[model samples]
Each structure stands twice: as C-alpha cells, then as structure tokens.
Target: MKRKISTLLTFLILSLLIIPSSLAHDDQAKHDADLMCVFWGDDKVSLSSEEKIAFKIIANAAAITIDQYSLNPNGRIKEGTFNEIQEGLKYFGLPELSINFNDIDLNIKVSNDGKNISPNTHRLYTHLGWNYKKHPNNDFWKKRKHVLIDSVNRLLFNSKKIFSWFPWASDVVYPPSEQCDAFCAIIYYVHIIGDHIAGDTADKLKNIEPLIHYTSMDTPGIIVELKEQLQIVFQEQKNSYTFFELDQKLSDLTISIEKNCDILGFIDTAEKCKKNQEHAEQLLQILSKHLPTLLKNESFFKSRFK
Candidate 1:
C-alpha cells in the first residue's frame, strides 16, 4: 500500500520535473509591480525636485510591468506596457534608464509537487529557503535537490506545516487558450488530490466551481482545508484509476488546445508551454505505476508526444 501510494506520487513528481530546481532571477516578476519602493525607500538616494516628478511618471509606468511578462523584456519596450513605458522614458529623457520590473522572484527552495522539478522552471515553482551557512558548496546544492520531495511530505503528510507560496493556477488565472500558454500545474493538484472520496464530501472534487470562482485569493481557506481531504486518497486504493483518468485527460486537452486554442506567441520556448509539456511527460510515464494492466491498455492510453 505504501509503495502504491509512493508510485502514485511519482506521477505527480514526474509532472514537476520540468520546473527548474531554481530560476536565476534578479527577483523580478512582482507580477509587474512598480519597483518604486526600491528607490523611494532608499534613504541615501534623494531625488531632486525635477527628478522627483520624472520619477513619479516613471514609477507609474513601471508599475504596469509588475507581474506582467510583456510590459518589457530584454530591458527594452516590447510587450505589455511598452507604450506607457516608452512615454515615461521619453518624458524623463531617460531612454537609457535600466528599469527592472515585473519580477515575482520565485527563488523556489521547494517545489509544490512531490519532488524537485527540472531547472527550466525552478524559480517559477518556488522561493529560496537557502541556509545562511559558511559553506555553500556542492553539498548544499545536493541537499537542496530534495526540495520538491520535502514539499510533498510537508504538503501531503504533515498536518502542522504551513505553506509559503500559493500554487499558481494557470488554467484559471491565465489559460493558455486565450491569455498565456497552458502553464497550469495547480490543476494537477486539483485533479489528483480532488479524486479521493465519493460521497457528499467527494462533491468538492467534482465541483470546484466555488473554489475556482473566488474573486480574491485572500480567503483561500478552501485550498488549505483540502489538505485534510488528501488523506483519503493516501489511504484508499480503489480510486487509483482516478489519478490515471485525470492525468490522461490532460493529454487529450493538450492536443485539442494545440490544434484549436488561441495561443499568443511561440509554444515551444514559451515558459507556460514548457511547463505543460513536462507535466504531460509525467502523466505518460505513470502508465505503469502499480496498476500495469488497466494503465497499459492500448485503447485506454494514447499519449503520443515527441
């Protein structure tokens, strides 16, 4: 039973392999928040009367880039708030200004999934819990590799541990079809974890409209409460196929999305697509965990990805 549960988790772990161990970020992606605080809060950096107004305009323009991937990439005006940023830069005669914004700084000391992810999206998956040790050597990196595994235990096994980051739901927040690429990992948790029970309590998994419909993430108690519900699947074995079905659905959806979805840019290198691709690989690998017969069925499973 323990081994089966471990195998089940491996499917989830496989999906996370795409996320890099940690992203080398300058701590950007406030989702695109104005970095005014960086300069405004600095006591030593005083602005002149004229510079202050220019700063305000620049700050306002910069704020638009927070958490926004487009507003600016490569330190140049290309995407989201380009026009506004251009105006601010031109207004201040600061075309050469190196403004840093839209950095959410995901220094991922841990992955939300069961194991450490691929290095590509490491920063996207978590923040750094780096120990302030005198020796930050190979031993440190090696130890840090278990970040995702530790997260799995804390999230699923531990009852008292508190989570630091929110599982960013790409489907709800930025569905690849319309907004961004299909970079959703939260659904993996929702589908896999949500497949536990079968009665009135099981209704939560079947109907996630209420939880996903929340306008503000401030009251995300449901997400936390679901941890208790996770215990159901860990103990129950009858619903193992639920994991496979939900995982397989992802493959079908990906094919449909690629053929019909409205993608904004390139899908190959797009971070979101990269995430979705890796997650798909994990699902395909699960065709042999414990339940080899049902999963091995040629008709039941058809994931033909490159």
Candidate 2:
C-alpha cells in the first residue's frame, strides 16, 4: 500500500508538469496562427485627417452594428475600451495621433438580453490574451485572413462606388474624371495592393516599421518612401506587368503634386469617395497659391533657377 501510494503521487506530479507544458505548447501554436493571419491578410486603409474624422463615425457605427448583432445571438459585455479605437485606426491606416487610450470612450450598449457580441469584425477584440510570436503552420491564420479580406474588400468596393458620385464632384473644381480617377484609383489600388503585400511582410517581421513607420515621417514623406521601396520590390521581383506601371504612376503623381499647388483644386467630385483625396487636393492648392508667390515675389525661384 505504501509503494502504491508513492507511485500514484509520482504519477500525479508528472501529469501536472505535462499538462502545463501541453497548454503552453498549445498557446504558442495559437499565437503563431494569430500572427500569421495578421501578417498575410490584414491590409489597413490609410486615411487623411479629414478621412479619419469621417471614418471615426463609420467605425463607431460599425461597433454599434456589431454590438446590435451580438445582442441577438451573443450577450453584450460592457465595452471596455482598450486600445480598440487606436487598433482600429491603426488597422485602418490612420495616423496614430497622440490620443490617449483613456480618453477615447467606446461605450458598448449591452442590452439586458442574453446574446453575446460577435467577434467577426475584428479578431483582436475577441482574443485579448492571444500571443503573437509563435507561428507553426499558417492554416489558422489563412482562415482569419480570408475573413478580413472579405470584409475589407466589400467596404472598399462599395466605397469606390459611393465616393465616385459625391456632391462635390465637378469638372471645374476638381481635376478631370480621368485625371481624378487616376489619382483616386491609384490611392485605392495602392491601398489594396500595397496593404496586401506589405501587411504580410509586416506580420512576419513582427513589426510595422518595415512596411509603414508612422513615427519617423509624415504622410507625403511616407508616400515617397513607400513608393521608392515598392520600386525596389518590383525591380527585385522582375515583375513586368502592373507593378512597373503602378510604381511609375504613383511616382509621377507624387512629383506632379509636389511641383504644382492650386488652392481651388479638388480631387473628388462625389460625396461617396473618401475625404483624404479631397484634403490632399486642398493642400496642393494651398501650396500652389502660396509657393509660387513666395518663390517669384521673393526672388526665391530666380535665385534657385539662376
């Protein structure tokens, strides 16, 4: 009996040790999957200041919508605002302005009903304690990536249609349609393509600095930097299709934008398009109005040109 008891105790001790090891292994696998999903699939939309304001309303509406859906099937929790808004903004490619997490309130109205909030819109909200370092196979991540692609693709497709017919769209105020579309389309195309490409790279790198270092630069500078990097990527890949043309177009537009500024100029004619382009156009106009005068009047251009 004494020997049997000792054996049982030994077995119990070994079992306890194995259990935690198994759990840790499982958690490591899960973390890997999550990181893979973010790396290969997540492509956030970059927003200008005006766009951020507009999209905040959209994000809030989305949160409410998701909450309402959860109220039906899943019960609601008191919306503990965590890095959620910033995460969303970061995911959406907004500049992470110095807005403290404590200040931004994401109040989730929980109805007395028994349904829980759905986690489809953003996995980050659902998995709080998820580890992001370990990657085993990418199966779990692939599914998550598909979910995100479907969601963002729909929004982007719809955005293109709505923004094309905005009220502000006019021939005289904005550039011509071909020109405007070229600009708008390039932004959208780059967003989708670049995010898809860069996101995966960022995920593997476990940092966004390689893809988009928001702190080191502002919007225009970032755009220029990204353009140069992308040129190198395409060149390295020896891609002869859309890659070369897209890179050139973006480069040309960036340069054109830098060269001429017109305050009266606008980028969008429709209300449905994203506001960032409009704001960009507005900035260009301001520069155009001020830069020429500053240069010509002050003999700045003469001195430089001479």
Which candidate leads in lDDT? 2
Q: After best superposition, candidate 1 residue 271: deviation in angstroms? A: 15
Model 1 stretches astray by more than 4 angstroms: 1-142, 151-241, 260-306
Please report the TM-score between candidate 2 and the true structure.
Answer: 0.21
| lDDT (tens digit, per residue) of candidate 1 on 1-306 | 665455334423432322111112222222112122222222234555434433333332222211122111233212223233333333322221222322322122223443433333332222111111222133433233222222222122221223222222211232122100110122122222212111122221222211211333432322232222222322243356644464455445445434533441222334433443443334333322322332223121112100
Candidate 1 lDDT score relative to the true structure: 0.27
Query: What lDDT does the true structure give each of the candidates?
Result: 0.27, 0.29
Assess every candidate by TM-score: 0.20, 0.21
